[model samples]
Target: MAWGLAEFDAERRGKKEGYSAGLSDGISQGIQQGISQGAQQKAIETAKNMLTFGDSIEKISQVTGLSEEEIKSLIK
Candidate 1:
């Protein structure tokens, strides 16, 4: 079997493009996951601080969007 230069180049280009697209998608997903985790950690830290300052569970839950049960756990 004989292959021409154009055919070989086209196949190589397709493989490289596919790899680039997959890598970009994976990185985007990773960044979104990181942002979500950071926000959650920040909220928990704020809740802990509120608990320290004698904030009521109902108020903290309203401000931090944490459940009453979760806020109770934080005070422990």
Candidate 2:
């Protein structure tokens, strides 16, 4: 029947819309995670450089926003 067809079409459309929204959200989250990881890596690299220059662990932690333990790990 025409009504049954209409219902089916609506259901399919809803599923498509839901999938699109989920995919968009997933991409956005992935991008944010990548950016965060990249920033963290940069901070670590900077901390290592500071260490090479004989900077104190506390100073590196303050400047790079990393923990003193993390800076100490880089020393090894």
Candidate 3:
């Protein structure tokens, strides 16, 4: 039984592939955001540790990709 494109689209409130594709895309984007957040947090922690070792702000920024202002904020 061949189904018409219009019929398939109309079946689910005009969603051509239903909500699963959108849901999956959302989940994928969420995972990527989480990973990026975690990596940034880890870099900040590393920079803090480097500060304790008397590392220069320039060096810390180079190693962590954090701005000088961000590195200075960790001083206290």
Highest TM-score, which number? Answer: 2
* Model 1 C-alpha lDDT per residue in residues 1-76, reported as the tens digit of each score: 7999999999999999999999999999999999999988888899999988988989998998889998888777
The residue pairs found clashing in candidate 2 are: none
Could you report the Cα RMSD, in angstroms, for every candidate shown? 1.7, 1.9, 4.5
TM-scores, one per candidate: 0.82, 0.94, 0.79
Task: For candidate 3, report its TM-score.
Answer: 0.79
lDDT digits (tens) for residues 4-42 of candidate 2: 888999999999999999999999999999999999999
Give the top-scoring candidate (lDDT): 2
Model 2, runs deviating above 4 Å? 1-3
Q: Give the whole-model CA lDDT for all candidates, comma-separated.
A: 0.91, 0.94, 0.92
**Clashing residue pairs, candidate 3?**
none
After superposing candidate 3, which stretches have Cα over 4 Å from the reference? Answer: 1-10, 13-16
lDDT of 3 at 44: 97
